[model samples]
Target: MHVTLIYFTIFFLDFVTHAVKEDSGYWRSKARMEIRRSLSYEWNTNEAKNVIIFVGDGMGPNTITASRIFRSGETSSLAWEDFPHVGLLKTYNTNKQVPDSASTATALFGGIKTNYEVVGVNANVPLRDCEASLNTDNHVESIFSWAQAAGKATGFVTTTRVTHATPAPLYAHSADRKWECESRMPPNATRCKDIARQLIENEPGRNIKVIMGGGRQTLKSNVEATESDPLDAWACSRQDGRDLVDTWKRDKSARKVKFAVAENNEQLRKVDTDQAEYLLGIFANSHISMDWKRDQGPKGQPSLEDMTVKALKILEKSANGYLLVVEGGLIDFAHHRGQAAQALRETVRLSDAVNATLQIIRTEDTLLIVTSDHSHSLAFNGYSDRGTSILGIAQRSKHDNTAYTTLSYSTGGPNNYAYEITNNKAVRVDPSRFDTNEFTYSQQAAIITDEAYHGGCDVAIFAIGPYAHLFHSVHEQNYVAEVVAFASSIGEYGNKENSASIFAVDCILSFGLFLTMLM
Candidate 1:
């Protein structure tokens, strides 16, 4: 009986030990997964004292690469490449594969995916529907509005007119993004409403702190008699009838809107920052000219970097930090014109702007985001070495040491010209119907490339500072709003950090996959 009892006791002990081992393994696995989720969730929830979103309108991966080559020469990386974090972002709209600037900018500002050509409204509505009347009228709010509500200073700065689509998303809520300036019949006052007016009237007493860039004429209807509307003839004007400049002399709140209206660099430099909390600076009636065309000293247009730096200086003064939006708005214009040289130069200007902002940002406390709304159908083809001239197109044999003229117009036009169509071989030519005058005047023959004639391609996205890692993986255009909201430490996740380099790993994997395919 004693022997039987001992064997039974030993068997029971063994059973207990085995069960414990199995349970421990299962718990460990569960714990590991929980930790990963926690980290990722936190990675999406970091905060910053200031948020700076730098937009390179119409920029793409190739555009960034070419800009890097242009700025640092063939071998150097872009200034922003040194940012400690990086991530990819998608630029698609809900209804269209190819998105317009209006809807894309709306995604960034409103955190909602919208359809093409629509602005500040959700995607479900009909194209002809007005955004102001949509049921979502109050449900969808812009980042600027959120920042304002949070008591943080907010500003919008760009090379485009203040009323343009890229900047409109921040302050204006409208169905039609093209509502630039309203007009009426010859006898009547311009009765139509525009986005610019909506922004100015949105909040009567709240001060936005800093409003800069071109668009003087859009704001004023009344002016002293002059060649142009005397009121708006200045680079900047306070059309609200408050005479913010005079108020700056007396009233405290009016003084807060003290502004500088400069049409050139000279006027920009003379503004007194010591006296004003809110500023309005316009350098031109429309978008500023290209950097190459701009003059230096008092006459030249300000570089994107100059505008960015100035904007930060004003925004950082807020005790509660600030949200600032800066745009290199002309890169899109260059792409629309199919001028590669102009587009590349504008991209370099954007890189310079990013570099300037990063220099001022010390704490991983500030979140800096750089991206484009969508990509243009642009590409660089042909096999070339590192130092090969990007300006010229030459084709070299993939495996052998032979070279041929790789860049020429399939339409039998000059290489310098841009045509609308491309042949079966991926060569470009102008569509027969388009007037020659419509294309920019070029002395050289036009080359037609298949890629140039089409649309719908992935754009570029890059970010740094807290929670920026959340931008990784395939995501929607609204993901940008999520990332910004997360990084601001505003919604869902808050005060979390991502030190795991998961995003970095993903980037590496993507690069390797691309190289593997090439091999």
Candidate 2:
């Protein structure tokens, strides 16, 4: 609703042209559809029963725009773009201009910005020095903890390992994000705990109703891996000789807690929500496969949409409602590899997960937020035709008679960095050597580096439901957690008028969106 119309003029003209050619009644039909939206746009002032946050890692404005273009050529929007409230925020960390996931995710979930590589701890804690963080006094609790204390079921789902930086802050507290398992701890940091141990043994962690994702090796030994022995050829393996997965199951059995564990998509689908009190699903020994590599057979993990649907079913069992975080994390990794085709496909898969979540819950009482932790340096260039293939070469660079695609990154990957540095992209490359449209092909980059870098730019936050209007202005990244806590009537900002304020903002934002769409 708060989006700019100028940026969408191209899309608007395309629709109008089609309508005029199809039938004279098409315009009238479109007007009635807008009226229906106006009716469905009412704001509910009552306390929200649920809050879901959908995060797209490394999704920036450039990333979104390029993805929109590549998805179907002329389309200019995704599912979240239709939301009633949208705004941009600065993503800088307290100590660095371009923040990493540890600090940025901590700010979003803990409501306090800290130094780089610091997760679920305050700014007073130094990065990677666990000796200085041996005590519990330095731990910073995230919003998930607040939800648990309030008697609400809390959970998180991501394509990355549940012990990864983003999800770790939701439940685990450590001096460093890299301390994923007991064996990974530094020599002098044995006094402290690893993130995986904390997740299965600590407060909010043990109490969580659902924990799903990859990281089997972080808990089970590499020898026990089901899909592949020693699992992904690219992932780290556990070497501590302890089977924490079995230990976790033993603890649950001794406590008489009813639980279900699934290793593949088929097993997860058979879980009966009515009978199971807890669910644990780990699909890979490391991070789950990317969208291109996803196979839903007996040996494969569930897709992002599959995971969201299952998580929602488990969480909705609570009468008090729930708070769940679903993250599409591999967009960052694909970008790191300079694979635009792969990265854009991941974003589309993320959008599919968001749409699936919407089908299970009504928007009137639920607060849904879709955003990114940070951005990559990927961008689109050249003024080609509106409906031209987004992945097709738009022009032959004057710098060298070599052709270039609309999408390219600042730096990263072998074909991009090494090929460019060695020949300066001036080797009169054969167009047939690589197919930009192929799902596995790597995209192009400008400079040379082993991995792409995060960008120092503002990222957009799209929202719908109560109190979303409070996010209209440009603000610090930490302010997002404050707005979420206020809307849900939790934490320090919980008060008598919280619901009233939320209702008021809903009406205002809906009206603003209506006017913008009319223009």
Candidate 3:
């Protein structure tokens, strides 16, 4: 009853707001679009020529439910939630029960469960042990290598730095997830390579046709203030005096590989993806701004939707097909800071990116999978009224006459250095005074610790395309790569080299066997 009342109230409010601002045609058009979306659903069983994976870094079931309820009382579903195949992915790493991005990434992209904090390596290697990583047996191939080997274009897009844990596993094999640049690497580990360097120097990593995200500080010898959002600047500037971006450009030039770097909205608009086979766009120095707040700053950042469309513009040029991975990685970053509003906005941005990408591709021929690297510590509690602002305090706790937020994290960043949110004796606030819906709002966190840890829940994987039905059962996270590999006929699953001829002979033998039985 409470939920129904809340929905009706929100719907009425929205109607009034739209009545004042938008024309009647807007309402008619929106209804038509919604109907079209429902009618467009189809069982795509055709062999996938292209594969696109969208990773919502910390989106667990709780995150999805919270997002849905927050938007309105259960009336809306995320764009990808309607996908034909939804599976629960077991995310425990090879060593740890609650895995981090690097380990989970190796499982999803490398098709193997690796040790915690290690990226693109098998379980044979230990974390941060530089020497152990040098063994050839420790190295593991990723989706990028398999795609490239099969003569397909490959790329990845992320809200985090391009060399961050999630995207790094696509091409980089690092002993330490912290080894993003030379400055992060130890002098003793000379043989071990950092992520940014490997991204430029390694095989399939260097050969990536579309690389878009932040990490300008890691790529440059000196960090310059860009008069935009200060968050775009990184604290750990490269001290080695080697400009990796310049080196990358020189290498591409020497090899005659066409590439362009689109660093901002203006550049992104100007980059002619058709003229260039390779593109690298780094918009920020560290991680990019949160999606909703991105436009508020003077610094121009392209929306995830814009970046996805641009990537497809280039990757679509490949006649053999392409493999692209998109990461809404900042959702995890915000959750660690105990920022619920930011996380929800990032998740919404990812959904919008998926919806936009769907507009440009044929669903039957494109295998699209949406999943998360791991779950966050964000929790929803209290007997909050349904439709209570997701970030608002549920009416004061009758027990102590103190109010608590409907949304909160279990732990926080160093005794809540960034923001304080304690459970037992939390500072109460009047929800009426504060705008909980603000994008910059950081929700309350229950515990006071150093960085909220990942939750040990099975994140969801939503799929649409050929063999998507294979994801019907609950399975280990590594099965993700195996299913995609088999569907696309790449890597070890590349039995298609003579599969057509074998099928024809089997059919002929079936017919000939009938005559032999009669004889």
Candidate 4:
């Protein structure tokens, strides 16, 4: 409700400015610059102190557009609509036109394009097999790594496996990005150590204060040690027999790391943030369910919003501030399913998470950025009103009649099911209503696409907090690095000192006053 009111207030202010400009030709000339300046003042700039980045995995432009219509009652402007800055990011790999999770995440966190399957390393050479692992040693330092080195508390939270692509590369370095655990993706026993083991047992103690998400099954064994999984032998030393969780407990450096294994939301909510320094909450055995199925979340599962809020509470305690990365990991799952309804629903969930984050952000010191690594092919089509349903064909009218679908599927129907575009813009409830139990929600509305597979669509990014103005162009993926580096006062090469330039410093102070009138 607060977010909605805030958005409406901003809209009204923008409307008044537009009206004034229309009445005065002279005022129109300065409108663009004035708009930029007004936006520049929307946050407190005097004491820019922290940085938080929220990445909606696989959420592109089409995803945000679709989500807006569902979440806002009617589509007008999104919460991020007031951001004066915008920018494009490149997601292509050094070897392929399309990139995978490992390389895409590596580029975002590591700041260099790597091979399709590599993590935390640059792809300098070509012609490597798809499965060939890239060495992660000596790569660009991750933002989390930098934060830890600078004496700031650093943490990772996600709906995906904690060691998954997006969060793993931040602290773990390995030749094979796919190796999730010492037991599953074991290191070459003759050549190297296990990345998963290093992630828990080998890193400098107390660096990662909080680690949350799923993949616990991969970290533990049903019984204890055996010759079959020698890693289990080490696990047997602990009562729990979970290598990752147990190892952290045994390490003196991590004794201060507050650990919690929340299999459900109830436990998550009860977690005492004050006492927790290093937290590990794996809410699911695998990846947590998407929002559509979130209602069916496990007995104690925590909503993504709950986890994010808890994470912020813990990170905010640091004197030097902290770096926290929260991932809406289910958006990618929705896209992979080619279920637009679920995709949009989850995007709305992501928006709710964003709203919650903004609630606790007190100063302009924090830079809050929301973006996707790449895009999918899905998009908004046809001329329709704000609340028009995106699930079916959109029809145009000629005097008194409706038009037919300009786009639709070619195959897969009972009697070659043909749909018509209509002014009946009622929201669709089910996309697969008629299909058998083999699939669910057939009647639910969804975007019609050429393939049953996901496409490359443009991703949407919204920002309002500190240094967000830096992201205002259609540039490459590495642009995010520049924005974060500037916001956190970290240098590009990881050795430079933190400083807020004139614009950055001013924006910080002005944003507070601007929100009073504008928000």
CA-only RMSD, every prediction: 16.7, 7.2, 8.4, 10.5
TM-score of 4: 0.73
Candidate 1 lDDT over 248-273, as tens digits, reads 22443444555555556777676666
Report the lDDT tens digits of candidate 2 across residue range 1-519: 212342254357445764475466766765675566546554546667788999898888888887777676543467687777789878998889999888889888988888898778888889887866665677777888888877788888989888888888898777888888866677988788888888888888888888898888787665465544236444445677777677768778898978888889889999887877788888877888888877768767899889889989989988887899988898887888878877888898888888788778877778889999998888788956677777767777788667777777888767664242444544544343578777666666667677788888999998877777777878898888877777787766456576677668889999999999999
TM-score (all chains, Cα) for each model: 0.70, 0.86, 0.84, 0.73
What local distance difference test score does each model get?
0.62, 0.79, 0.81, 0.60
TM-score of 1: 0.70
Q: lDDT for model 3, please.
A: 0.81
- Residue 190's lDDT in candidate 1: 37
Give the runs in model 3 whose Cα sits over 4 Å from its true position. 1-43, 226-236, 296-299, 414-434, 497-519
Candidate 1 residue runs with Cα over 4 Å from true position: 1-46, 131-139, 184-192, 204-206, 221-257, 396-454, 491-519
Better of 2 and 4 by lDDT: 2
Error of 3 at 176 (Å): 0.4
lDDT of 4: 0.60
Ordered by TM-score, highest first, the candidates read 2, 3, 4, 1
